[model samples]
Target chain A: MNSLTTAFFIAAAMILFAGCYMLVRSHNMIRLVIAVEVVMKAVTLVLVFAGYSNGNTALSQSFIITIIVAEVVVAVVATGIAIAVYRNNGDLDLRKLNKLNG
Target chain B: MSASLATLVYAFIGLPLIAIVLLNLPNRKFAEKLCIGTGLFVCIVQMATAVIAVLLLIEFNKASMSFSQFWDMHVADDAAYFSVDFLSAVCLFCIGMVGAVSFAAAGSTVRDKILNYTNMMMVLLLGMNGIALVTDLFSVYVFLEISGIASFLLIALYRDPVGLEGAFKYLVMSAIASAFILLGSGLLFLEFGSLRFVVLEEMLQAGVYNNPPLVWLALFFLVAGFAIKSGNMPFHGWLPDAQTGAPSPVSIMLSGIVEQMSGTYATMRLIDIFLLNKFTVVNIGMMLLALLSIVLGAIAAVGQTDFKRTLAYSSISQIGYIVLGISCGTVLGYVGAVLHFFNHSTFKSTLFANAAAVKNQLHSTHYDDLGGLQKQMPIAAATSVIAGLSTAGLPPFAGFWSKLLIIIAVWQTQGAFVASVALLASIFTLAYFLRIQHKVFFGPEKQRPAVKEPKDGIAIASIALSVVTIGFGILFPVLLLALQTQGVL
Candidate 1:
């Protein structure tokens, strides 16, 4: 593989790992949402790189745009639920959201 | 004939959009009053359309019929279009049946939120229909998101603490799954320069890709993503929580159709296009996952105290059967898997409807709060028995024939040990369901206020689904004979 492609792959992998780390480490609900967004951004980078490598940048561009739109809606809904959870428990701590269990 | 087929195919996507538009065009009060009727109308039409399309396709001796709604966009060589074949027709029918049941239950359970419920239900139906009809992987992702969003909002509609928690958990896991799926598809697109199923299938069959390792990596991500979406064993933490926390009607929708459409259906399509009759390692991997889910989900369900939670875990187990059938990679296995998918929707919807009935009358579905309900709620009790027996794969119930077919296919292909393991798991299914029957219906009477049967839409929905389950089970042999006569078996 070319040096440019290698660099892109490393960057995407690093971003993915960082996002996953945040997802595992965060104690706050809003931070979890941000972590999900970060992961999605990494996916976006991969899609863009894939398209560029394949000489089909336009299709990948459209795909990325659609992904952005869908992820935004997901973020809105996640934040909305998080806000509702906060109102119920008076905090955004992830540990407090465990009422249902086996 | 083709023209009529096109119209019928279009209805699956068009009717729901029309219903959404008409419902919202009126004023808020008017929409609220008309929402249930509109929802039922859309669902019934969709069910009828699916059956008719399937019949027409058969009569015309065609494998599938493709159609577009607004305008024909065949300008490019590989522009995406929607099509309906036997498999998708079956899925569409399941979506319609389950959507109808959800709407019926919602009339009683979600009276105040009826309008919002109907709106989101239509969107969910639209999304599922898109998933069933779309010809490309990217389109599947789009429809998955649409349905995923609708379900998350449905779970959080009441915004209660538990509902919010369920929705948040579902959203987080689902988002991660989507990232995995998109990355996989991106990797595929990088190699193939197209996302159409037919093109990818052809390319894979020709075996001319430059980057074989990249293809395997893509497959890995896709499998993991879909496994998560389907709530298979290891990735099943959110399923029970979401199902248990959602309101009863929404629970019916989630367990009945949403999870199957967004997850298992995609997996089936992926297998059809990518792994069918090849990739034995992937097939074995999927089979192992299915076995794990089947054994563990049933064992776990045996210990749950709550009504919805037990059924949720049971759903995980039942879905495992469907995946097991798929992983066999034979025509018989595919047929068995599709039939099992249909049976699961019918019986699971009936069970959830019974849960709604109990919750409505007693206001609690905990084992501690339920006892001797059979004497009072005769219909729910009776239907639950039928549905539960069907789930346990007893004779003369719909679930039995499908499970038997799956086990036989596994035996023929994967060997006796795997088949025997699957067969033994049914005993656990029966054990847990009997526990439900004993704890919730036939145990010693609790000294509490006398409860009556829920004289509402939920009761009617459960009865109808129970009838379908019983009818399908009894008629399956005739169907097999007919298929044999046609040289299809």
Candidate 2:
């Protein structure tokens, strides 16, 4: 693989592992949200890179990157709600909210 | 179709999504009206676009080209992409149709956050459409999250504690599934350096991975991801809670068709495109999962007293039919899976409308709490019949023909034993639906429904959806022809 593609996948892999670790490790809702962002970012990085080496199409690459930035607000909207969830419950240890488990 | 079909295609996927942006705009009152009006507008446009999409599918099928050419890879000159055929059009119609009907019905009930509800609904439809159309692996993953998160939020719309829990559970399962894809995508990245399903198939066939175990493991991870999303068998724990707790409109979307779109599309794309070379075995495993889903879903339904929970299990059974068809792997099987997916969307959503209506009228989702609704909401009772009869595969209903097709197709290859098993499963489907209908609608007239019926979009969509169910149920032949043009029949 070219250095560009190799570098891209390596960083994406690191981001993904880090995100998963954070998602598992953090009980804080905000941190979880940020971790989810890391997952999204990792996917975006890997996708753009894949588009670059594989599809090699300008439209697909640009489109993938644009989707990354474009999705922030929507993600944030959900995060805002998550924050509200934290406020109401006093903690983000999601296991405590078991009302729906039945 | 011009290269610009992508543009129109993008619009069909973008409009509802753009509404999300519109919702946050100034003036709360306008946001509500705009959301409803925009939802209705998009529904109409989506239905129209669905029609055009069907036409496009016919053209593409006639030309025998379900693959589109977008761009190229480094070593690979022409990358493979998907073009619409019957399967996608059917889903597109359901997504658009149910969306329009339900949004029109849900009006004003989604108070306080008009723009948010409307925007989420549209964006949900958009993500679904993107999933159905895009053949790109990465694109599918992105859209799946978009749609899935939108769904989670819709369930959380009521701000009930249960809704939050529902969202969290769904989020966790969905996150795990997405990670599975990323793992596979990462591996595939190292191998093919590409993510397009069509292109990856060729590379893999040429033995790009070189490790047979790696290939098997990738397929397992990928399939598991989709299986989790589709809620197949053991992975289906999230459906009842998530679907029941979500808003009625979201329930309609989720139960009616969202999972079918994402879950089935992912499973199918992985099986058909990535491992078409190994589908004989893979499909058998899928078939086994289908049978298990049918039995467990019905058994699970029997235990549920909640009206919406019962409907959720029914969805599990409904998903079984689609998976079973794919398992058969004949042209008939593919066609059956596609049509079953579509039919489930129509009737399931209609059924959820009934459940939603009952819940709205009674303020209770428990079936035992809701009695004699027929006297109170005759339309819900009648429409519930439409949904129930159609889904249970009674004669002259849309589901009947599809179920018959699945049975016959299965019989052709698997012999009388499997066909008999299929026959028995349908009976189980009927038994539970009949039990629920009787308990919820036909039971003795009790005190007034526990909750007052809200003047909301549920009523409007109930009528609209009922009309669709009856219309499609009766006009089976013409519908078949339309689907045939798109290769579903």
Candidate 3:
């Protein structure tokens, strides 16, 4: 692979790992949501790199736009649920959200 | 004829949109009153349209028919559009069937939030129908998100602690799955410059690609994403919690159709297009996952004390059977997988409907809170027995034929050992279901306030589903004979 492709892959992997680390370490619900968004951003980076390399920049741009829109909706819903959880538990900690265990 | 098919295809996506508009045009009270009826109407019409479309496709000897909802988008060679084949037609019918049952249960259970429930249900229907109809991978991701959002909102509708927690967990897991899917699809697009299934299929068949490792990486991500969506064994952490924590009607939707539509349907399509009879390693990997799910899910269900949780675990097990059929990579296996998909919807819906009936009356589904219910709730009890028996693959039920086909397919392709393991897993299925039957329905009577049968929509739905289970079981042989005669077998 070329230098540019190698750089892109390395950057994407770093971002993905950082996002996953945040997801695993964060105990707050809102932070968890942000972590998910971070992971999605990493995916977006990969998609853009894919398009750049494949010479399909227009199609990839459209795909990224749609992904952003959908990702925003998912974030909104996650925040809504987290807020509801906070209301019920008076905190945003993940430990408090374990009521449905078997 | 083509015009008529297009109209039918349009109805699949259009009817739900119109329903949403009509329900919201008036006052809140008016929407509340009209919501259940409108949902039921849309669902029944969808069911009819699916059956009719399948027959028409068969009679005309067409592989599939494509149509756009609004504007024709055939300008480019690989532009995305909607199409319906036999597999999608079957999925559409299953969605309508389970959606109808969900709405029926919602009629009595979700009285206060009826309007909101109806609106979300309509959106969910549109999303699932989109999944069934879309011909491209990116559109599948778009619809998956749509349906996933609807389900998360629906689960948290009451905003109870358990419901919110379940919704949060489901949201996190589903978002991750979507990321995996997007990354995979992007990699595929990088290689092929297209995400349409037909284009990908042709390219893969001609074996045209530069980087084989990148292709394998893409396949890994795609399979993992779909596997997580479908709640297979390793990635099933969110399934039981979500199903148990959602309200009963929503549980019906989640277990019966949503998981299949968002997860298994895409996997089936992926296998059909990309891995058809070629990717033996991928097929074996999928088969192993299926086996793990079937055995582990059933074993886990046996230990669960909650009714909905047990059913959720059972759903994981049944989904395993479907995946196992798909992993066999044979025509008979594909047919078996599809039939099992349909049957799973019917029987699982009936069981959840029974759970709703019990929950509506007793307000709890814990095993300790239930006993000797058969004497009081005969319809729920009797129907649960039939449904449970069907789930265990007993003869004279729809599940039996499908499970039989799947096992035979496994035996033919994988070997006797794998098939026998699948066969023995049903004993665990029977064991846990019998536990449910004894503890919840047929055990010793507990003295408490008078418990009468829930004579609401839930009871009616269970009875209707039971009839379907028995009827389909009896009629399957005739259908098989007809398929044989037509040289389809």
Candidate 4:
């Protein structure tokens, strides 16, 4: 792999790791969604890099489109659920929503 | 006839989709009847297609064929390919049957938001059917997410605190899983310059990838993604609540088909393609994960008192069994795993449907709140008993033989430690299920408010499933022969 590709890989991996960490660490619902989106972006970046390096831009571009569409739907539904939870419990805090414990 | 069978597969997928639009027509007065009618229509088409597919398989003596190959020239070169094989057809059959049952068993739950519920159910089924039939990695990911989104909405259908909370948990975790899948697929695409499973299988078989480290990383991500989606232990926190809180029919769809399609089936398909060539660290890691889920999930289920909650925990434990069977890396193990997938969907969905029936009757699912219900809801009680026994792996039931196959496979592959744990887990499974049966269905009548029999739709659904569970168990040799013919064994 070239230095530029290596750099892109490193950047994407770091961002992805950061997003996963935030997903585990964040207590707020909306923040969790943001963490997920961050991770998604990192993945998109990787896909783009793969496309560039392999010269399969069209396939990768289509994949990116699919990802974006799926991402939007997930985000919207998640936001809607978060809003519903907030309306019911009056907060977006996930810890408080633990009524159905083992 | 061949052309018609291929078209049947599309009709099986498309009818539900079309029903989604038709159910949403502007006419309000006939909406409920329209919903039921469309649901029944889709169910009939699904069953008819399943029977014909089986007949075609028998007539041809072929294991698998590309149903979409005839149309390949019409679509773009990059368009995804679909095949109707033994496994995919069986998966479709189960989905179609359970889906039909769910629609029939839905009773009053979908009555409130009939259009919305039917739409989401059809979307979920379409996604699931796609997952079973699609031939490439990207399509799997797309379809997995499609089904995942449908499930999240379905879980939140009640709009209550518990329901919304369950939905959010599912959403967050699924998002993480999807990220892993995307990253893994990207790595594989980089390696092969194609997203097709057949290509990846060939490369792995040939050991063509130059960078072993990246391949390992990609495999890890893929396995992790599928494991999370399957609701395996440590990654299964979302499942219990989601299963417990979703409206009952939604629970049937979620627990019955969605988890199987997204988790176990996907994992098996990938493992068949990638890990079969070389048993690496990924396989060992998966085995460890499987053992962990097997033991821990069973132990955890013993403590849950809520009815659906216990079933949810039981699902995790059972999933562990499926994973463990797959990890054994033996053909016998594969048979066990796939058979367990089929058996579990039948019995567990029946159990959940029964729980829904009970909930509908008594408006509660807590263990302490139910008792002596046999006289009142004999169908629920009887079906629950059969389903419970089948789930716990009682002899003469579908679950028993599959669990036996897995245990034998593990004994041969992983030795006595894992085998013993699996055997012991079966006992725990029986214990917990017995507890549910005794406390909820057989004990002295609790002086509670009287409730009516569970609705006929759910009762009929449960009965149909119960018969299949018993039939499959008794006729397991035939299934084995079919599997052998399909080259699965």
Candidate 5:
């Protein structure tokens, strides 16, 4: 409703944007996973912000559930793959993974 | 028959959307056959519908009659439209021919996971056709993701380490692009409270917004998101990785259809929506990218020793032609764009199939490891010539018509210089394709152990696709006319 709240929401979105971009830009697998976790939190914040702005508790509750599901499922599965890749190739740096490069 | 044909079309799309229960169905081999049968059956139905639609389209065209429908599932002021218009129906023709030919060729290559293969292929068909037919923004995103996610999974199914890497990158980049799309979509929805493309178009045209910072930002994100899928210069990083690392059959589909459909359709759709105000800037900007791709793709292809990688670069250059055509914003321009899009799918699929066969015959895809396939595989050699010639835009080929129109469109709009650059790029396209074909298939035979003709399925498949190329080239006049009648060209 106010500029302060709008600023908070915008900041939250920027944080998520920055975190995801960092994850993609980072060469380290661990850091990438950590960045992905940040994105999860950011999206949660976004849902909460939107709900709070409109006074929609139902929306926020569903948003929290979606965030939990994302963290538990997608983040976990991707982390496992990242770890496996790290173990197999002996590196966490994406730059080193060019076996797929043509 | 018409009702069943329409029903079949719906099922052709819907069945892939519904998940089928996996059966233990003996070994993977039996599963493969089952998938092949299902995929083939779907393709047959598509072909039947396409033929029937063509017959109907003929009557509609002569009488200038169109059976159109509007569905407004939202509260938008305007509706999302779907019609069996001449443009869409003709696209169905391309989809039917290519879908059938590719399935026929894929027989056992996808034998390992037949059901999954069939599912993905069917979804791909649904997604692609939906993109061609649906005239709504939200529906576009839904179908775009349907195809994009399926494509990533299909590539990942290769299970090789390289394949996994490619799939991962594709998934990562595609997710980011779609997120940008969502962001753009969310803002648009917030402003207008509707996602229907027709409604959005009306609202924008009402002078409510004129190149606002937010709209431009949304457009930028939309372009960037689609560009990743486009596999253009900067965002093209994923392409060689994905295509070269993918399985042979997947390579054929990805190189031939996926990138072309998503990128070209996104651009065309955007141009349509934005045609109200930013026509000049959009045209100039896209023309710049098209030029960049022309030079960059040529340079990249010239440097690649890996066969599939080279084809990947060639694809980039070919996409330049598509972009150049549509961006010119002329009727002839769109004609060239749509026709070339159709032509490329036919020719490039054949090339990839032949590439698969060559890799099979030689056990490697590197240029140094392959030579003189003419004697051993005459059919492949002959088909390769047709494809190569078609890509080079040689006369009497469908490609020539598309490229000629593009060059003319550019020249008429801008200058002789743009046209000259395009013409020079076509020569570059010809040179590289010829260099590879000459060395690999037409040169002196290097006696090697275990040299054999290509496998029956791939050979059969390449021939089928090559026929598509030659047939379309010969029938370019009729096809162009159909596209024009539909106003898509």
Candidate 6:
């Protein structure tokens, strides 16, 4: 409800929306990953703002720590998969990653 | 009773962890049978735990007039963040049954990396059980991540081009879902200063939040997050690829259990927490999405030439029925939804197992590659027919009864027009399945060479599932009575 808190919330939502837009637009696998990470960063910002607004900073901090750990694992695995896909298909474009079409 | 139910939940959660460690004994050489034996034992124990949980829940419900109050307080008093009630107990039962059956159906498919496969599977089971039992929103997110990672690994088990592609798609979508969920949880925590489901439910019921729009924003994010996780319409791009790309048994688990738990089950839990009091937005959204998936998935399935792809689309269609049932927001609708969930898992796993059997023999499941396989793989062929009929909601099969209940529930709530359309969709379901049967089982024998039957494990698994489908339908009254006793009806 404070002006600063409201500003943070607005910024967080804008960043998340921008990241999602990028995710939808990009076909490059690495770029897609970056977009996802950006969204996650926005989420982290929201969580921080949440904790601040709710006066539960410790809980939100712990949640952010766990989220970071999990995010790292997902990022590593996705990067590995992206590299494998690129090596196999000769590109990182999702449009080209279509060997198993419906 | 409450204390023991809590213990049972912990044990159910712990079972898979134990299996994970046991399957990964560093010094010991693991024979295929030994690894499978371990998996089977763990699965059986999971089912046993579910059975006990259900029985205890029924007894507790009978003994207490204030079931929800006791249920809410029982585990909130405990420092641990897990709990179980009738809904969770039933979900655990479905998870156990589907997971066990999937392992049985896996059979020889996992012969190469039996230890690794079984370990990952056990971890997946752990994650699902954890998701079902946990009462806190953060814990749900944590468990969802656990299962999500396990599924990505399992889908990419072969590490081939298609597998990797499928896994990447799954990862990207899942990561987006996670972000949405985390953001939603953050908003919710800001509203209530807590992440516990009970606390949130109380706060919502008490109208404690200041900003209604923020509450709606959180609910929207959560619902969208779970809708993506569950593979609803317009967000189901990863499902067909993931199911088709994974090994058949993994497909069985993915299509049958994982989607239900992570997607529908999780969505249902959230609805209970946040949407039950104000049903207009979530209910209407879920209904519209369900209708879209049912129609589109069926139509898309009708055009697929690949056997697995057809099944994948069919899963989307069938999951639509479950969602449709839930969207009605009536007790009859809930029963129908839960029953359909159980039946879908049964028949879908059966169909996937048979697909694996076909793949095992032909090295492909394309319509062009398969013809008149009934003579060669009679058990699989027969079971596929049964499963196909069941999936189409034919008479004397589990799918029929569940679909009937769901239609009736929809008629009562959403009215006759929607229910009638749902019934028409079943015709689409039957049409495609019959086409598959004709193409794969009754077509002219293109190849005169000897056709091998399904291996013993898959044969037995499919047969068992087929029998259960038929038996559950025939014995619907018994099941209804049991559910009635448990206060689910």
The most accurate candidate by DockQ is 3
B-chain TM-score, every candidate? 0.98, 0.90, 0.98, 0.95, 0.89, 0.94
Q: What are the per-residue Cα lDDT tens digits for candidate 6 across B134-209?
A: 7788888999999999999988888888788789888999999989888889889888999887788888988887
Kindly list the per-residue Cα lDDT of model 5 for residues B1-489, writing each as its tens digit: 334324434544554454233423456666555766666666666667666665765754542122123222222223324434445665666666666666665664555665676667777788777766676665576667767766766776646677767876775666566556655654455455455666677777775853376566667767776767778777788888888877777888888878876777777778767662255775787788888888789778877888888888989888888888878887778778877888888888888888878876676788788778888888888888999899999987778888888899889886899999989988888888887787778887776885767467778877877777778788878967866777664
lDDT of 1 at B470: 93
Candidate 4 lDDT score at position A91:
89
Q: Candidate 1, A80: how far from true, in Å?
A: 0.7
Q: Cα RMSDs of all predictions?
A: 1.4, 4.9, 1.3, 2.1, 4.3, 2.9
Ranking by TM-score: 3, 1, 4, 6, 5, 2
Chain A only: TM-score per candidate: 0.97, 0.75, 0.95, 0.97, 0.82, 0.96
lDDT of each residue in B1-489, candidate 4, tens digit only:
454555765676677777887777757667766886688678768867877787887788766555454354234323438766767777888888878878887656667877778888889888988898888999999999999999999888879887887888888889989989989999988888888877888888988988888887888899999999999997998898888878889888888878889989998898778865266566668788888887788788888888888888888888899988888888898889888988988999899888888888788899889989989988898999899899889889999999999999989987898799889888889888988888889989999888878457888889989999999899998877876787766
For each candidate, what TM-score against the reference? 0.98, 0.84, 0.98, 0.96, 0.86, 0.95
Q: What's model 6's overall lDDT?
A: 0.84
Collision pairs in model 4: none
lDDT (C-alpha, whole model) for all candidates: 0.91, 0.73, 0.92, 0.85, 0.71, 0.84
DockQ leaderboard ranking: 3, 1, 4, 6, 5, 2
Deviating ranges (above 4 Å) for candidate 2: A1-82, B1-7, B17-26, B59-82, B204-209, B275-277, B449-457, B477-489
After best superposition, candidate 5 residue A64: deviation in angstroms? Answer: 12
lDDT of 2 by residue, B347-377 (tens): 8888887777776566678766877777667
What's candidate 1's DockQ score? 0.85
- Ordered by lDDT, highest first, the candidates read 3, 1, 4, 6, 2, 5
Query: What's each prediction's clash count?
Result: 0, 5, 0, 0, 0, 0
Interface RMSD of 2: 3.5
DockQ each candidate and list the results.
0.85, 0.24, 0.86, 0.81, 0.29, 0.80
Poorly placed runs, candidate 4 (over 4 Å): B67-80, B275-277, B481-488
- List ranges where model 1 is wrong by over 4 Å: B73-80
Question: i-RMS, every candidate?
Answer: 0.9, 3.5, 0.9, 1.0, 3.8, 1.0
Tens digit of lDDT per residue, candidate 4, span A12-100?
Answer: 99999999899989999999999999999999999999998889999999999989999999999999998888888898888899877
